[model samples]
Target chain A: MDLKQSARDLAIEYLLQEIKKGNLKAGDKLLNERKLSENLGISRVPLREAICTLSTLGILEAHQGDGTYVSDSYSEIFSNIIKKYGIFDRSMVDEVFEARSLFEADAARLAARNHTEDDLVKLEQALKKHENALTDYYEEKLKDKDMMELDTEIHLGIAASSHNNFILEIVKSIRYVTLQQDYFSEQYTLDHEHFKRSSIMHREIFNAIKEKNEDLAYKKMQEHINEIRLALDIESIRRDIK
Target chain B: MDLKQSARDLAIEYLLQEIKKGNLKAGDKLLNERKLSENLGISRVPLREAICTLSTLGILEAHQGDGTYVSDSYSEIFSNIIKKYGIFDRSMVDEVFEARSLFEADAARLAARNHTEDDLVKLEQALKKHENALTDYYEEKLKDKDMMELDTEIHLGIAASSHNNFILEIVKSIRYVTLQQDYFSEQYTLDHEHFKRSSIMHREIFNAIKEKNEDLAYKKMQEHINEIRLALDIESIRRDIK
Candidate 1:
């Protein structure tokens, strides 16, 4: 029932409205502080806070001694913001897996159709990294962190090969959440058996993409994610009982 | 390659690292500004900017007489930030549609299985609103703005019924972008036929969800989104030729 609007939010909302109304536009310099604050009918403190917020989000760019201007680099900003803050809860684990199952599987299919030579090279390299990480884990030479990162790298590589920015960003955001699993829960120990099995699945997914077998790539990726999800489902159910 | 980190970014990163290392906990008040700024080897100016930025994003909260505190409300913060800046480019139209096709179809299926009575009531109301908007549009009484909003409401309502916060937030972000289609392009005019057809699809999808027909709900939502994508593809192709 708290309908209060913070001063900073009001200022931010005003600027967004101007942008939406076409009065403020990409690359357009904002009005100087005194004039803007006067026009907004608020003091400069909240106004400055609003600008800082927008600039941090990369929606606005500020040049020292010049002024702030609307930014045209929306794509990168969008990716960075989502990657940094999109997933933050332990309860969101199942949702993340569900999202990855749908999006990453489709990404694999698209990669099979659209992957460039460079993408194939990257995917191969990522797969190699996963295998090495798995070996190192078995030999007690690597930590679970390396295994998790390498695994994610392969999935992100496939998302890149899909040539769809949305998939790449979405995968990155959700994968980031999964990587932080160790941060939230007891350190997520990667067993040698699980690591070995994951490596095998990654190899199969990579080979499918390499061979341009779209359906196989999609199915393999789905199975791999589904396998992981099964383990997570069991863990969550155990937690509930506890 | 600009490798230089801005002062504000440095401060923000330092704070995030502290949180990650468990040195700072949610609801814990931040160190006093003077002490924190000294610790970071930076002046208070950029530090304040960092705090302001996080506060605006809801990652941190600032109280006037008290101090800034790490916030536990990360889910709401994640949703707000993405909804505000996630989709920012004209080139992203195709990507948005592709994401929607994958996520929303799955969400519809989940909704069929998981929706509650309240969810059904909300969805029904959204459907009625859409029908009314279409009627108003046909009668020359409604603007494209109302129609656009009403249309997105139904999709968002379906996403809510999925009972997955991730799906709800994702749908909200993407749909917010679509709503700005008019802001980015020359106003998007919804023709009578397109509106009518969309309304029909919404009703069918709603019925499938209401009847708890998971596969049918998924199929209907996919068909609905694919139909929209087909038109978009043709438009993009035409634009390329021109």
Candidate 2:
């Protein structure tokens, strides 16, 4: 590597080391540039570049006149990353769904094993909200945004029930990207039939988790995603024919 | 949200819109601060804040004195995000492995369907290198880093064979995080038996891919990961007992 690249790498390594050692943490404001550069034995130029790199990675937040801070939420970082990448093409969308299937299936399995009473209550509440949203939509009383938010809530509730922070964050990221795309895409639509089928599938998944049936939960979650994938594929084909 | 947050959001939305319209491309140098701010009808402070946010998210790169540019690669952004998050605990490790299982299985399935002659050649070359590295290690002639690199190369080759750039990139990101953690962790080690089993599993996966047996390839890939997970679990248990 050239001198510039090496310097940036050194800076990255130093910062990561600090984070790993707990010298830096999420939501912690970084020290002033001059002090940090001096402490790391690097000049201000490379130090700034490194900080800029970290910021671009969504690991740090820079507020004007407020200094830089480590990001407290991985979900925000993930949503930003997805938006930046613009993963909306058909193939990319398919890949995202594939990822979601895996993540949610594993999440369902874990939730079956790990959920507490509070989690069960939250899951039921989310499910009820989703069911009510679907009912309102079918009755022509709900907006798309409301249904979308409710749909996201139900999936996120199951993810949270897994009791694994990492899984929760990953699921949130995937859901954010998928929902953002759906919200913005003109081709995305939810008819009564799709909503009806989706509601039943959601209930089955919820029940499987509630019963603590890990295998059944995993299978149901996978089937739920596969159905969605099939619906998306059909829509794409219809668009193509149109 | 506060005024500052709203301004930042506006800036982010504006930039993302520009990107989606192909007005901005990867590696394209961003316009000067004054010009961009003026064009957006926003002041320099908010525009700069927006740029800083993009920079932190790895969507843009800032050279020392040169103008900022869109990142050429998303993998760099992903690596930075992973490092910043520092997902190293047991549950996080399991989550990462779950992600890998999903990603690699999908990649393997796609590779089975999509591999061209050239891809097969590359895959064979990577597998051969891995096999050689394992042999050398068992003969006490190789270092851990060498074997690790070879192992990564084999998986990356399979990902590349999938013929999907998005899948390839996601797999690369997952592997980078997992390998980085393994490289730095004192708990990570590979014994001869583990290498032997891994070699067998890799060949099985390769053969399944070569034969265009998608189901078999997926199954083998999942099995390969499960074996690794089992080995890690066993090691953790042993550590706990000791």
Candidate 3:
């Protein structure tokens, strides 16, 4: 390994531990390059790289004359690190699923309550794409990947229509973080019945939104997320992990 | 400015424009170091630095034996940049308000439907502290600061009691992102009148939770977030920015 790379990793590890211990906070400018070098026993070159890395992850900030500061709090830092560990890690998946359930449920409720005509059009367009992907049903090659992508599109559409950028951003991030695991797999191909059920559920959610019934929307959204949970066989996975 | 940093800013600015124009995407790796230097008319050092910065942002990822690939989609990149900007510019307050409105409303609904006796005690404790802060009605001199903090504390308390870590984490992160607005100036001094009213609202929310009336609890939480909306005045600020 390169010296600078090792040094950069060290800086991240040390800073992560400190933040985890609550030794740092937002706006607390970080140590200067020279001082950080001295403190970490690494050269300024690698320390700067590490600081810059964390800065990108939103855990640290760089000021022209001042210094780097720990920016994000522990939980935020944990979220980023959790991404690095990948989604198949049962705990992370559980966390993501749990988070998604909360978000999607709320999103559905909001969309149902406040969806405008425009929101409805966008949602219908997304549903059309999902339906189009189903045309390849007999051809197993495209079934799995297409379904996942379609599912993401539908969810993203719902989040977008809810008019909440923050939730959309987080949900988008969640999708990115879990891309390798869920976006493409043979499951959609193998579980044809599940795909049919999911299609019906999507249609039901759309109808609920169209009817502007927040309760039905929330319930359907919850059921949809729970369906994914069950399809992933997460309950068994969670038990196995424990 | 350092040469590499100057190079990085230029690269970032360049790449951001490309992303905005929809010219880049995931899995699209850039040219080799030598080729990129030739193309951009810069030395390898600056090019490498720029790529590293983008890489750190998770927009690009460098493969040891391969090239640099855009690790994120354009929307993901934009979201990160926007989120960071919100924090640095203090617009995160609005972001927090939007998210909290949704989360709190949902949490209230859930808590009312799901709260146990233990949950009641915890909610009661938070309410008590809120009342205590009111009695100590020394005007909190800082305006922007301390606004969402206890709000977050109360939120976390409710989320924790609601027994939903997903809600807890998102709410936690929303607070985390906004806290990036370094506590610069405190906004309003505690007007005894205002504090008294706020205390009453807290009590109202408490009573709703105690009563386990999901609709009432949700309505109360919605009103609470609106009150905070006025306190933060996020929507107007966003309008002003645009």
Q: Pick the candidate with the highest TM-score.
A: 2
True contacts kept of each: 0.37, 0.09, 0.23
By summed lDDT, the worst window of 10 consecutive residues in model 1 chain A runs over A183-192
Can you write out model 2's per-residue Cα lDDT over A188-220, one digit (the tens) per residue? Answer: 544436666878898999899989999899899
lDDT of 3 by residue, B1-242 (tens): 67766776676666655653557666777778898688777777667766776665556777777877877532243334444332221244554566778777767766776678987887787777666665344565533244345555676666665555445545555555445433212332222244456667767877887788878877887887676455543444454432
Candidate 1 residue spans exceeding 4 A from truth = A1-90, A183-191, A211-213, A231-242, B1-90, B183-191, B230-242
Q: Model 1, A54-74: lDDT tens per residue? A: 887777888776988998754
Clash numbers, per candidate: 0, 10, 8
Over the stretch B24-89, how does candidate 2's per-residue lDDT look in tens digits?
A: 988798889888878777777667767765665567788877888988754665665665664443
Residue B225 of model 1 has an lDDT of 88
Binned by DockQ into CAPRI classes (incorrect, acceptable, medium, high), candidate 3 is: incorrect
**Ranking of all predicted structures according to TM-score, beginning with the best and ending with the worst:** 2, 1, 3
